[model samples]
Target: MTCSRMQSVVIPRHFDYRVLKCKVSSISVWNHLSVHRSLAMNVRRLEVLDERAAGSGMGTGDQTKEMVPGGISSTETDLEDTDDELGMHEKHEQYLLDALSKMSHLESFAWSCNHSPISIDLLWPMLLKCHTLREVEINDNLVFSPVTNDESEGDSPNVAVAHELRAVALKSNKHVYGSAKHPDFTRVKGMLNSCPNLESLNIAYTQPRSLPHAHLSADDLFLFGRWPNLTSLTLTNLRCSPSTGLDAASSFLFAHLNLEILHLDMSPGTATWYNKLVFPPNCLPRLRELKAHRDLVSSLLACPSDAPRPLEIIKGVRLTQATDLQQSADAFFFNLRRHGVNVKRVELTSWHEMEDIRRLIESTPKLTWLDLGKKGNGNHHDRLGGSGASSSGAAAKSSSSSSSSHFSVVNANEWAILLSAAPELTTFHGVKFFYEVSLQAQASIANAANLPLYANGSTGNSNSGTGPAPGATAHVNLNLMNLSMTDRSRIRKNDETASMLAWKCTKLRRVDHWEDGGGKVVVIIRDCGDGKEKDKVAPRWEIRRVKQ
Candidate 1:
């Protein structure tokens, strides 16, 4: 690449680096990465996961590196040929340290292991070298320090603490259903002590479960000093310590005045436990996004905040009881209206009727993305993008009116008519897009766009509204529709949907098509004509799959 090209090369802040054992003369990922020294200097986040990288694992063979003195190597060698991996691990650690030391702009560093938890002694040199590093994440059973016998107090080694670091995420070695048996308090405390400038803390399981039972507790949190900079907090799988545990946690949350985002997915009877959850006066003044179990959503938002904190996202838990889809949606809309919250993105788990869905849209008109909760949900999506007989005239309804007994099968034209009120909407989910091109559907879309419909894109009389709108264009902004039915998500025929709505919704950029074995295919609606040829300018459609 040329110097100009190299200068303009955009390096992603988040980088996932994996070390693989290759047979090409011990050439490592580091060897290739080191060539672009500029890339290393600008890295903000990095992950190292390999068979024997750093503290991931140290082999247990009798072949120790021939020592000069105090088991120190005068000259470091690569680990490809060494089975005496303890001494061999030093070389890998040296390679890691050398690379980390050069990342002056690095902010976040993540490390993982494939097996058991190990001592993080190997990470000390790395952490010490990264001056601007603000975050550290480890998936290994990476312990802080060994525990002692004393019940009240115990002796744990004085580990190096990065006062400049702002975030630390610790995940279990295992990622199955029992992801969080929960690490010990002493170990958590040791970690807390190591990174005292705590701002954002995320200790949650990596998977989904009905309930998560953890040994970690609220009392353990009180062991550390209050972080004044703490803004975002996520606690997924933990039981209340006891009678006073949840109370202490409540107090802890209330005390943090700067908190903005909070996800309290407390488990093992998650929802019912937080029914009585309370917030102190004027607490969470800057709070914006709140996610928790559905049962706890109402109670959580019931306690009014002194400030007018406009929440942009509220993700209540997935609904296990399908019977209350209507009641549940009504309650959610009530909160949005009562709290005066205007959200941009919504993920409605389970399902709800069309009327309930309409109420939600009216409540949050600024919605840019809406997930109708996935298909195979309580109310299944139309495999044929079902437009029932009642929904046939759905396109004729006013943008502000409710449906006329339409049960299912909302076509592209109906969606265009319904979502026309929210011009900012782009990515829509939950509903299937089974809209096949037809005269009625085309006419409806054209009406929604404030343009006259045309038959077969041919210019005709401008007297009737159904005739071509002489030089008019679509006013619609809807684009990037996502269907929940994976089997029927793909839009066929060079996007017959895009072509039909082209006169009405000109800005429709891309739609998602998911084939079970294939990755995501994006429909690109590009304007290939020049401004000089305004009359000739038309949208060109292209399809490409996003690499997984």
Candidate 2:
């Protein structure tokens, strides 16, 4: 029933019944008449790879017949005549169509063919007979043409209703390149309209390829509104006109209030579309998660004071290239804060400044998960933290004074201040901290002296000393579940300091220190309740590195 390397299969002539389920990469319908008959009669679910036609009965001219005693070759000419009678392409197409026609009771069909294009004219008529079909996936090259006068209209009552169809995916083959040939947008739209009750659609291309000149435009995408009950929609590399703004697109999307997730990778040229995108208040009431480019995020943030809706999650915001990263971030965060929007999760796919991080923590008080990690890039050392801040001139002076040093390290003192700001933080990833014994010593001294660390009520001494102050202890109450850091050697060298830092986090569980070249040394910390008086006493903590 399950196979990975099966090239061909044969069914005996006596097997005249149906196949309830059939999954195969290649089928030799031409070579085995009984197999073809069996498949045609009873395939409820059919999945095929359709890599190439099998058993075409064609042989290379290199096949030669042995000369008999009379110097005559008999079999070669006979084979050539047979091959000429049944052309490879024609035979293959006919056999596939015939097999499809036999499956009148089929409910689902999936074809993944990347080698060659299939004519929809040959497949559509067969599908029209499977009125019970519910799902279809065809990831291949499909040549589409308009219906002719002799053919029935797509929406005619004579056509199969396909009322049970709920999902369809018609992604293009990855091997097809250039914009020269592509699925007709009109035909694709017509096909989608046929699935009246479809709820989920994913037409995203997996690989890079230029779309045809007549690709879907902003207005064409508005056809999505036809799927009234649609819940999830994903379209990648969709081409749009430069003259068309996001207003139309947003209006169309707003009509789909039931959508829970919407992901779009608009054509690169449409990056400027964000400038015109708008979200009216109370729009997309059920949309909780969105994954798009920075433009969409910027557009949402830039909405009129009375027009924006509260979103639980907004991902793919870019803050790296902002003229004033801090100002831009503050504006974005403050806008959300002013509107009383309680976005619990935010993901920035670019570098963020230290002040921006501070503003983010300050604005999104209910945020539990924050990810500022760079994707697809191995270098983690260049992340902006507290190292290069001009405001931290005194701290920078003690370290490398060179302006060329790009690595920003958030020392223990800075971390205490930041972590203290965000109490609800549970998962923090992709931030590097500079760990050193001297910084910990300063923090210890400040705590012992009962000196206020910063104006923010943080307790950490900036003055470095030989050891911890007498009766000095570090304590913090937080709900942090995971913390990821870079620069391992520094953390390893200051184990005592790191331990002190870890001890303060009451709900701390795990720490990840990433190496420069792309490996992580994870340290797991478990809170073992204080023995004998577990309820009344604070829990004791244990820390150990997880072996690779």
Candidate 3:
């Protein structure tokens, strides 16, 4: 009898298979399909009882055989436990390993492992084998053994790792750069010259101490300048003096013109060095984005002032500190407008008071996105009281620190002024803690400027119009993540300042405020149509509360 015929011999579902296996311990089929020492031991026991019933002439063979889902016979069911199936299982595991190995191409593999020590030798072979390796992020107190070449006795990790990765991000280390015993920038330069396709480099440390200017010979540039495709470069807190290998890197741009992004987050003291030097014409004509955190905006802009075109294609700009706020503001905007660049977006890290904010907004008329907020307290008391308190000698001496700390708050108000200036602005993101007087006055100013306001809602759901007016979407976008105000009781309804805020921002879509227990309450005002549904209908604004 075949196994298929046995299925037609109806049996109880709860029949114990182990009892029958115990009775027929001497069976050959039971020995072949042993139940012991296997992961599927219980499955094997069921098969043994099944075979015993078939052997006992449960039914006739061949005609009434059962066909499995894969159309495999009982003969093939036995093949499932054979060596061929094991081979297929092994092949599947290898296929998975190959897929995981290729993931290093798009991502930084070094950062992927958070709490495991990476095997350098194991990885070196895989990296050498894998063609898709692009970025290697070895940070977070990682201790790696020095890389050794095949044929060198005194080989100090022959810098072969550079040939594999396009970009290397190294951070949080004891040494100034990546290596513990001081990194020779020449070794890195040599590695870069060897790799035909290397693009970006990121390194940040406690100090900027590597490579003496005297040691960086002219041969360095001759070797390094071979890379015509090199574009983006970033160096943070690197002790690169005027004489050091800085010229070797800069010379590449002067000779060939394919650089795009340059991020220099250098030490505060070394920032002023760039202002003194000048570059050749068309050195960096392809340059579009620049991020300089320490230097005064005026000095950095002075570097590319004489170029055939002064960064007309430039899109993004970030400045940490601006010297002589009013003067710096004027110079920065004038250069962009002069070039007809039309700076669409801007982020101001430091600006204090309503006057500075107003000046910036009025100057940059085409700004669409702005991230302007307070860094220091503005001497509002000084402005409100007519500068008389600071005019006194004794008061000036006692309030020097307080006065400086007070400037950041005033700087934050400058953002509101800029918003008023650029009525075309669509998105304003950042912490806003300006005084009520300035906010109200600026709101009125913005309203008079013809800036249309839309509440935070889906354009499809908007009853005001079919959708947002073409250029009006950029004006206001509030961050509603983890709101702090939940209940109307927590907000002082009768307070003079609170009342002013409520009335001033009549065009507001959302309002977030603080409540008890550090929770949030969000008030969403939607534009539901009034009783009349005319084209020019004044949409009703209904405020709904969202409790924490």
Best by lDDT: 1
Model 3 ranges with Cα > 4 A deviation: 1-108, 111-126, 140-166, 173-194, 206-226, 293-333, 377-418, 431-548
Would you list the C-alpha lDDT of every candidate in the order shown? 0.51, 0.50, 0.37
lDDT of 3 by residue, 188-240 (tens): 34334445665665655443244222111223433354545657766565544
| Candidate 1 per-residue lDDT over residues 1-548, each given as its tens digit | 35755544431312222212211112243444444466557566565553344321242421211101121122223435576657455545555556656666777776664332323544654675567878887665444223545622633355566778988787654444223344455656655666656889877543324323434454667435377888888876655654666577668877787888888877664444565556666667777777776655665555577666666777654534366464754575677667645577667654434555566667776777666664334543332133443333322333332332123434567655665555566665555343222333334334534533232222112233333334442222121122122111222332445554454444444444422224543353434434555435444333345666
Best by TM-score: 1
Which of candidates 1 and 3 reaches a greater lDDT? 1
Q: Worst 10-residue stretch by lDDT in candidate 3?
A: 39-48
Count clashes in each candidate, considering only residues at least 3 apart in sequence or on different chains. Answer: 2, 0, 31
Clashing pairs in 2: none
Q: Give the TM-score of candidate 3.
A: 0.48
RMSD of each: 11.5, 13.8, 18.8
- Which stretches of model 2 miss by more than 4 angstroms? 1-25, 28-47, 50-110, 120-135, 141-159, 177-184, 205-216, 242-247, 298-310, 324-330, 375-420, 432-523, 529-548
Q: Estimate each model's TM-score.
A: 0.61, 0.60, 0.48
